[model samples]
Target: MTVTATRSRAGVLTGVLTAALVCTGLMAGIFFAFTVSVMPGLHETDDRTFVTAMRGINAAIENGLFGLVFVGALGFTGLAAVLLARSGRRAAAWWAGAAAVLYLLVLILTMGVEVPLNDQLARAGDDFARARHDFEGVWVPVNDLRTVLTALALACLGPALAKRTAGVSR
Candidate 1:
C-alpha cells in the first residue's frame, strides 16, 4: 500500500481502538458502579423498594443513550479487529482481535442472561421480595463476569493503541 493510504488506515484503526477503549471503560464503570454502589445500596433497602428501583432503572437504561454506548463500544472493537487483522504488526492485531471477542461475551451475557432476569423481575409485581431474592443470586455474578470481561477488553485495547502509535512513529 502507498504510504499515505497506510497512514490513513492506521489512523482510522487507531480512532476505532480509542473509541473502543472509551466505551469499554464506560461500560466497566457502569458495572463497577453496580457492583460497588448500586447493588450494595439496594441490599440495604426494603425488598419492595429494591425491586421497584431496579425495575425502573433497568427500564430507563433501555433508551438511546445507553444503547449507543453499549453497541458503539462493541461495533468499534469489532471494526478495529477487522482492520488490524491484516496489519503487519501481529501484536497489535492479536490484542485488537481479542478485545473484540472479549467484549462480544459481555454483549451476549447482557442480552441473553441479564435482560431475561430483568424482564422476570419487572413482571414479578407484588412478589418483589421473592423476585429480587431469586434475581440477585443469578444477576450479580453474571454482571461481575461482564464487568471483568469489559475491563480485560480495555486492557487489551490499551496495548493495541500503544502499538498502533508505535507503528506510526517508526
Candidate 2:
C-alpha cells in the first residue's frame, strides 16, 4: 500500500475508534444515570408509581429491544478495537477489548439472569401482585453488577483513547 493510503486508513480508523469510545461512554452514562435516578423511587414506593416504573422497565426488557442495541454497540466497539489493533495501538486496543468483555458480561447477566425473570413476570401480567418484591430484590444486585461494570468500562476508555491518540490531532 502507498504511504498516503496507509495514513488515510490510520486517520479513518482513529476517528471511528474515537467515535465508538464516545458512544459507549455516553450510553454507559445514560444507563447508569437513569437507573440510579429512578431506582430509589421504585424501591421507596408502595403505590402505583413503583408498578408503573417496573412496567416501563419491563416493557423495555420484555422483547429484548435494548439487548439488540447493546449487541450492536458491542459489535461496533469490537470492530473499533480491531481497527485500533491493526493501526499498531495494541495497548489501547487491548483496553477496549477488556471493556468489551466486561460489556459482554453485562449482557450475559441480563440474558441469563434478568431476561428469564422478566419473561416470567411479563407472563404473570396483571396477576403479578404488588406484594411480591422478589423481582426487585433479586434484580438489584444483578443490575448493580451491570452498572458497576459498565461504569468501569467507560472509565477505562478515557485513558485508552488518550494513549491511542497521544500524538494524533483530532
Backbone collisions counted per model: 0, 0
TM-score, one value per model:
0.92, 0.79
Instruction: Find the 10 residues in a row with the least total lDDT in model 2.
Output: 123-132
Return the clash pairs for model 1, or none.
Answer: none
Write one digit per residue (lDDT tens) for candidate 2, span 32-121: 764687676567776455655666777864456554556755666677678777767777788778877877787788789977766665
Off by over 4 Å in 2: 60-69, 127-131, 166-170
Residue-wise lDDT of candidate 1 within 53-128, one digit each (tens)?
A: 9999999999998899899888998887777766666677778889989999999999999999999998887987
TM-score of 2: 0.79
Residue 156, model 2: Cα distance from true site in angstroms: 2.0
lDDT (C-alpha, whole model) for all candidates? 0.86, 0.69
